[model samples]
Target: MSNRFKNLIVPVLAVVLGMLVGTIIMLVTGYDAGAAFSALFEGAFGDIYYTGETIRQVTPYILAGLAVGFAFKTGLFNIGVEGQLIVGWLASVWVGVAFDLPKIIHLPLAVLAAAAAGALWAFIPGFLKARFRVHEVIVTIMLNYVALHLSNYLIRTVLSEKSDRTPNIHDTASLKSPFLEGLTDYSRLHWGIVIALICVFIMWFILQKTTLGYELKAVGFNQHASEYAGMNVRKNIILSMVISGAFAGLAGAMEGLGTFGYAPVRGGFTGVGFDGIAVALLGGSAPIGIVLAALLFGSLKVGALNMPLEAGVPNELVDIIIALIVFFVGASYMIRIFIERLSKKKGVK
Candidate 1:
């Protein structure tokens, strides 16, 4: 079978298997799986409001997934996306609240601030990895804790003295759209979705059509060989991480400017960055695939909220289902082997 076909079928099979397993678990636990899933779909798309909210949820996932997937192309594991996102969130809010420029300048400035912060945060690990052979995963994981505490301290001391969150962003800097909100019964839908889609196109264009992209891929395939081929391996590594971090930062900007309009002292991680890893894996690190994966996850998340109200099922069941889907995705090698064996058996017959 063609690799493209294999890629397409794997995720589809994973989703089906995940749902099947979820149903079995529900049946074993004496719950009505059919009603639960019905509620899930209904909650995700029953009305314009729910649909809008689901799309809003999808915006960050798309950006975050791109962040991870972009790094994957360069053979980097950017586990510090959470930390980069946090710093980006803080930076965007700082720019939004601290300035009083025109809308054209202010909005872009805030967004750029976020991208810069995330890039700078990611640059540390990238530089270390290139310079000293440090493992990115370890550095990034440690940075996550540092980011959480640093953001909280900054919010409490510099951003706002009276509250745990900063003041709301100025109208000029906000991504909120009154028209979209009205269309969706005042849901938090915003223009960030457009930016996310644009990023998707940008990712595809860069990876498929650029010399730099070719170099990054070469370096990823084999660093020593790429270096021998006259590629600057270290430069490509740093560039890849910086670009990936920028995407991650943009994900934070979506939350800050589009969803919340302020930065708060987070007690824990937002979980978006971590979820991005699974999204990248499930999507096979393809641009379009990442968007589809994000949509599925976003729908599941929104739909889970309705389980308790409509089916007397806990929302956490969706988490379990998602986990199972990720597990199936990780085990796709075995599935491929099974499919190959069956194909050979059929050919012999």
Candidate 2:
């Protein structure tokens, strides 16, 4: 089999195995597996509203997955994507609430603030790694807590007597599109999906076509070799982290501007960032792969809501299915070997 064709087979088999396992589990538990799956599909794509919701759900996942995948490409484990996202969310909403400008200016400014805040948030860990050889994973994990508390404190101090959330951003700053919403029958879908798709192509262009990306990838593959070749491994590491955080920050902006038009302080981390880790891993860390993986996870998430509502299946079963999918994806080497063996048997060169 050709390399491109082989690349497609493993993830597809992984998905199939995941669904098969989910079916077996449902059968054992006395739930109607067919009904559950039917409801899931219906919820994800039944109508304009459902389709819009699925797209809205997918938008943030794509950006967050890109964030994790980008860092992984540079051999950095960015555990703090969650923290960066929190800060970005707050920063975007803060800018949106503070600004009173034309729509074009206000919206772009808010988005830029979000990306900057996220990049800055990730910079701390990057700095530590570059200056002291400290592991990024630890620093990022600790910073996640710091970000959570810091945001909470700021919200209370700045928006005191206003509850956990900031005021809705001005129309100029909001990402909501009445025209698009009307087209989707008033779903929360917004312009963020377009931005996400653009970022996907940008990611592909950078990683596949840019010298900077080549240097970053080389450093990740072998820092000592890259250093001997006169590459600035330290600088590349830091730059990779910054870019990763920026992607995550954009995901937060999607939630703030498009989904909520404001941010509510949270005591705990949002799972989006962590889910992104799975997305990145399952996608083999490729730009296009990550987007496709995000779509799969997004559909499951959006569809799971209806399984319980209409099929008499527990929502937790959806979690089980997701866990199974992740498991199969992580163990997909078996599928690759199986395919290779079958190809050899067929003698197809």
Q: Which candidate leads in lDDT?
A: 1
lDDT of 2 by residue, 68-88 (tens): 999998899998988888888
Query: Lowest summed lDDT over 10 consecutive residues: which window, candidate 1?
Result: 1-10
- Model 2 ranges with Cα > 4 A deviation: none
Error of 1 at 187 (Å): 0.9
Estimated TM-score for each candidate = 0.99, 0.96
Residues 1-349, model 1: lDDT tens digits: 7777888998999999999999999999988999999999999999999999999999999999999999998899999888888899999999999999999999999999999999999999999999999999999999989999999998999999868999999999999999999999999999999999999999888889999999988998999999999999999999999999999999999999989999998879999999999899889889999999999999999999999999999999999999999999999998898778877898899
Candidate 1 TM-score versus the reference: 0.99
lDDT values for all models: 0.94, 0.90
lDDT of 2 at 166: 82
